[model samples]
Target: MTLRRLISALLAVPACTMLAAMPVQAAELDPVRVQLDWLPTGDKAFFYAGVAEGIYRDAGLDVTLAPGRGSPDAVTQVAAGNADIGAAGINALMEAYAEGGAPVKAVMSIYSKPPEAVFTYEGSGVTDLASTLGKRMAYSMTSAPWPGVLRQAGLDPDEVNMVNVSPASLAPMLAQGQVEMNLNWVTKQPDAEALMEAAGRKLKVLPLSEHGLEGYAYSLMASQRMIDSRPEVLARFITATREAIEFSIAHPDQAAAGLAKVVPESDPAILEGQLRASFPLIDNEISQTEGLGVFEPQRLATAWRWVAESDGYAIDAIDPAALIDSRFLDTAAQ
Candidate 1:
């Protein structure tokens, strides 16, 4: 063989060998499922914004955002490995811990304050917790806030004529006098009011935070196995969510428009009102400073104790650490 041909053959042989040794390209993005606590609302703006803005895609995730029936459903879905992450109330996390589920941890707080409250019509003669006693009250049986509010108000939840209403039913029930009082979140009041106004009525909202019904409202939770195996994915998810939250705060009108696209059934005016109402509740600064999604351990402990004591569970049955993993949030914020 010629010297030039021999050299070329040698290079070609190595090139072929190198090609054989290389690993095959995998899927361009990792799949992740995020289960929301309920139907789309302004409270979930960050999540919707993340998906709408391709924030998850930018973070190397192919995220699927699913609506959960409620907090319990979201917890069960994550615990059963059906979902990679669940956004739900922290109170639900505590309840799950008390019940001994596949350990779950909250990675981020969506609402800086608890989102729940007691809402009444302007002329319902129910201005406070004391007034709600003996009045027909509407709430979802599965809502974590209901039990807390009931216990706090010293009302026999059963004696108050509890009505199981969907979150969307709050306005209609209130307007028709089907229920004299409604338990809901501050963020939801605007939507409820808009619905009532559409029916030529007005409503008043009383935040639970003002009535000693305080606890972490919503958080992003993941299973222990997922946290142990793919923490980087969780961190990336949190980072993207945080960015979406920041964007939502800075541009409420655009955020409302983006959220409206996701929940097409939602009234644009209602969503706009909710977006404005939720502005003060999304405290990205606190989350950034304390580490994304990190609730005060002491507060968590207090909440655990409250749940155990109020629900007649043994104190030893609860372990706050098992219910939450703040380290993922700390690493994500960094």
Candidate 2:
């Protein structure tokens, strides 16, 4: 059967029935906290949809979602056992493994591809990465992947005068010529574009993935101890999340509404644009083939190697497999 049909049929089934039909013994509903990598936005549709649609409750979980300051803060919360799971970039997880010896494993990938990119005004004379040399580039102090992109382009990041700018201020800074370029995520690209169009201007976005800086974007992660002790809970969470993601893909407008409810201050037009921008980044293939929270060992190994070699960590000291667990997702699929 086609995926659409399967998803439709799954949606038709009663949530209680689906929960009761699962073979593995269901765990009692317990409070599970998830720390988001940033504040509410359309990029977080599936998560908000899951909550708004009662997916987590149907899966027998009392889940609480918390906003994180950034990836590092989210990872720290998970590592400290204060949060059951944390949503963050896989790069942050690698850094945590290298520096803090945090036994956190990425359970589910949200964006299949890296969302980082450099944005410049249209006709800025900077058409590509090579042209960005010696230019002023604005970047967030906490964002990952920019360093890798600069290194791969053979540009010393230090050579470019860098300024700290908020994500929302990127387009404004570009429009005013305050910075030659700024790094942003694809998820934020739509909002940036909308903001530019509002002022009757245009911009160019150069995705880092297209420039050879590849890494998984957002992911659901948990500590090794939690995985060992509460595997069932993780599996249930993944199942519920997979249901939510599939729902979002099939019902984009509904997903947008769900996001709007959580982020009421967001402009509908901007939210719609953000949703469209993020569509290509969400990987249906990974969700279908690997189940919900499964991590590809080889892909993760590549990420770890990139981090270790560039960030001054001993490669031999880190094992990628130790930082991921697929059993929970696998169980959920069954």
Candidate 3:
């Protein structure tokens, strides 16, 4: 066929038919391994929702969500190149960075405010930090309020007799009077309440942040290599995650179903409640002003100082700017 004749013949065909005959370009999905700081929980339902709903895939990521031992484990895994990213406490990351140089940097702040709290039974007369003195308490060794928080509350960390306890038994221990109180996140107050009510007791939750121990909470940490070599991949992941969080915030029930599909063992209602609880933590004055996935440098710097200085590390040991890069968040927002 002559070139002019071929062009004429193509033009004569239906545009839809011609388009169908053209080769389609399939975009390759980038691999992204995320190490969750602990076993799957309702509070983390949005991650499962993101996967079940194809949020990550739509954003060009072949994301794998894996259960991790804890924040320290996740940080070490990401720093050792065993994982591309880590979902863990921002304070833990700062601690790791203070130890030396962590190979990861925070890309997004998952919790705008710290979620640490102390739980007690009703009429226990354990009202404040002063009441905790010489009292038996169960607390996750990993998550007790730091020295700075203790000082802010005007209590000595050494005054409290703290016993390490698993989250599963923390409530039961309190019910049985094995411990006067326990510590956990306020978001889990509902579950704790349910547990206490089942055991015929009332619950009192005292959030440490309300007493001046506030700091940035959970965050998304990416390996420095991934940030440097595949910035677009991280940006896409954040965009997808942010969208999933927004959807969960708006439709907790539907988002819970999405999570239930991924983890049927988890009660959908519990997951929904957990997701609902996270919404307040996710959206605060800072988030309202700066938008999601963005962090205030001054506040972040202050948090770093609080964590590092309190931990007896030199202020220069960990540079807050280096630990947080807003470029990906800016890109994802746009």
**Which candidate tops TM-score?**
3
List model 2 lDDT by residue over 1-334, tens digit each: 6999999878878776878865443466666788988887777777888888989889888878888888889999999988989999877888887776786788877776668888887767678877887778877775345666678778776666778887667778877777878888877887777667776668789888788865466788987777988888888998898898888878867887988887788876666677667766776565456544556776677677667755767887678777777777778778
Candidate 2 yields a Cα-based lDDT of 0.77
Top-scoring candidate (lDDT): 3
In order, candidate lDDTs are: 0.75, 0.77, 0.81
All candidates in order of lDDT, best leading: 3, 2, 1
Task: Judge candidate 2 at residue 276 and give its lDDT.
Answer: 66
165-230 in candidate 3: lDDT tens per residue? 776788899888788888787778767777889888898888776777655778999999899999
Collision pairs in model 1: 108-293, 109-293
Question: Model 1: which ten-residue window has the lowest total lDDT?
Answer: 284-293
Residues 1-334 of candidate 1 have per-residue lDDT tens digits of 6999999999999999999976453388777888888888776766777777778788888888888888888988998888989998777777777777566788776766666778788788888777777888887664445665667667655566678876667668887888888877788877677667876767888887677754466788988777989888888888888888788787777777888997888876777677667665557455556644677777677667666765677877867766777777777767
Query: Candidate 2: misplaced stretches above 4 Å?
Result: 1-28, 142-144, 154-159, 284-293
